[model samples]
Target: MNTTTLTGLELRPLAVPADVSELETPAGHDFATMMDVRNRVYFEISGHHDESMSAAELLPHYQPNPDEIRFMWVAILDGEFVGRAGIDIPLEEGSKTAFWQIELLRKSWGKGVGSAAYELLENKAREHGRTVLQSWASHPAADGVEQIEPPTGFGSIPDDHAAHFYKRHGYSLEQVERNSAFDLRGSFEIVERLLAEATAAAEGYRVVQWEPPTAEEYVAGYAWMKSRMSTDAPSADLEFDEEVWDAERIARHDALWTDAHQFVLVTAAQHIATGELCAFNELVVGKDRAEASHQEDTLVLKEHRGHKLGMLVKCAGLVKWRELVPHSPRVLTYNAEENRPMLDINEAIGFTPIAYGGAWKKVLE
Candidate 1:
C-alpha cells in the first residue's frame, strides 16, 4: 500500500524489525504518549476511564504471527502517534467475517486520519481474500438503540459513531450481544448464592464439579463444553474451524495459575450449566507489576438461566479463589452496558461498576 495523506496525516502498518525497536520502548519512555492516543480514541470515548487513561494492557490479543490475527493501522501527525485501528481475525468457531476496530486520539478527531486508516485496511483486506466484512457499531448515547451497519469501502467509526458510520457505509445488523464482566477478588460469595438458587430452581438437574481425570481427559469435556457453548452463548459471529483452541491452549492457561488458581465449574451430566470462571480470566504479568487477571467469558446455559446457575458457579469460583489466592487484590471484568442478568448478579456481589462500553466490529465486503 502506498503512503497517502488524508487531512495532513500519514497512515500505515508498523513495519516490524524496523519499527519493533521503536514500538518496544519502555512504558516510561513513550508509554503514556502512545497509550494516551489509544485509550482516548478507544477506551475513553466508550465511557472507559473517561478522564485519566490507564497504562496500555497486553497488545489487545497477541498471536504468535501478526498476519494470522490482527492487522494494526496507525495514523501519525508530525511524527506523533495520533490514531489507530485494528482488524481482528479471531480464529474462533462461527465467526465468519473479518471486522475492524477503530480508535482515534481526541485531538485527532474531526480530521480524516481515521478515514485514511480505514481505506488502507480495506484495500489490504481485499488483497488478502476477505470478501465480507462485518463490524459491531455503537450508536451515540444520543442514538439510543444499538445498531450494526453494513461496511462501505473505507472509513470506520469510534463506538459512539458506529451506528451513523456503518449506516452510511451499508452494513446490516447481524447480531448484538450485551457483554458483561465482574471483578472476582471476593465476589464469589454472591456467585455461590446464585448457584444455590439456580440449583434449587433446577429440580431434576444436578450440578457437579469435574476435574480432568488425566491431562488428556479434558478433550471430551472441552469438546462438550465447546459444542454446548456453541448452542447457548450469544453468537459472536465466530467461525468454528478445526477446534483451534484445545487442550494445549487450555494447558497454556493452566500454566499461568499459581497453586491458588484452578479451573472450576458446575455442570449437569452432559451440559455445562455454568462455569467458565477460570477460562475467561486474561492473566498478564508486566515487568514491574504483579500479574492481573481479568474475569471474562462468564456464561450459563440457556435452559439453566432461570435457576440462577450464573450466580452459583461464579460464587463457587470466587470462594475457591479466596481460599487459594488470599494475597490477591481485586479481580477485574468489563461488560457491555446492556448485559443486565450478569450485571444483576455482579451488583449483588461487591463488583462496583468500573468501565462500560461496546466492542465495535466493521466488515469489508
Candidate 2:
C-alpha cells in the first residue's frame, strides 16, 4: 500500500529495532521519537501516572512472531513527528479481523493528520485481507450512572470524547468494560480471608506457582486452559473467535516475555487425585516499572466451578507477585460489565472501578 499524503504531512512506516541496543541507529532514532510523541499524548489524555515503555520494554513487541503481524506508522510534518498509528493482524485461521489504533498529539488533533494516518492503516489492513477492523477507547461513566472515583494515579476521559470520535469514523460501540484496580498496599486481610475460604473449599486441589518457562509437566494442560480463555471470557455482542493454543505456542509466548525482561507469575490449581490442571491466573510486571503489575488472565474450568478455584489462584498469584516484585504497589485489571462472577470476586478483594471503555468495531464491505 502506498503512503498517504496530507498537506505537508506524510504517513510512512516506522522502523523499530530488533535489539534494544540498536535503538541509537538512524531508523531506531525515528522509532524512539515517535514513541515520545505517543507517550506524551497518552499521559495527557488519560491522566494516568503510568510511565511510557522504555527502549528495553518496547523491543520485544517488535520481535517477529509467526502468529501475528504488526505494522507501525508515523505521521510527520515538516520533519517533526505529529502522530502515529498501528494495525495488528492475526494469522490464525478463521481470524479475519485487524485491530487498528491511531494517536495524535493534543495540538495536532483538529488537523487532517489523524484522518490521513487512519486511511493508511485501513488500506494496510485490507491489503492483508482483513475484513473487519476493531479498536477500543476509554472514557468515564455516562450521565445518570453512579460515578466511582478512580484510584490514585489513574484517570478517565469524558464519555463522549472517544464515543463521538469512533462514531464519526463508522465504528459502532459493541461493549463497555469497567477498568478496575487493586491497591496492593491497602489491605491484605481480605485477600487472606478469601484465600483461607477458597483453600478449604478446594480441598483436593493444590496451588502451584511458577515463573516463566512453565514446567514441562504442566505445559500441555496450561495451554489447554489458556485456549479456553477466548471462549470462556465474556465478549458481549462483539464478533470474536476462539484462539488455538498448543505447547509450542505457549513456549513462543514465554520467549517473547523473557526477551523483553518482563516477569510472568503464574499460579495454577491442580486436582490432587487426577493430577490435572483445572484453573490458573497470571500476573505480569514490566522490568522497567516494578511499581505496578497487570492482571492478565484468570480462568476456572467448567467442572471446577463452585470450588472457588478462581479466587484461590488469583490470591495465590498476587501473594507470589508480592514476593517476586515487592516494590509493585498496584495491580490493574479489566472485566466486562456483564461478567458478574469475576466482578464479585474482584470487588470482594478490594478492586475498585477506575475507568470505563468501549470496544468498537467496523465491518468493511
State which candidate has the highest lDDT.
Answer: 2
> Model 1 residue 6 lDDT?
62
Q: Candidate 2 residues 169-220, lDDT tens each? A: 8887666677889987776888989999999999999998888898899898
TM-score of 2: 0.91
- Identify the candidate with maximal TM-score: 2
lDDT of 1 by residue, 298-355 (tens): 6664544665556655565555555544554555665433456766777776677443
Among all windows of 10 consecutive residues in model 1, the one with the lowest summed lDDT is 276-285
The per-model lDDT (C-alpha) reads 0.49, 0.80
Worst 10 residues of 2 by lDDT: 147-156
With a 3 Å backbone cut-off (N, CA, C), the pairs that clash in candidate 2 are: none
Q: What is the TM-score of each candidate against the true structure?
A: 0.64, 0.91
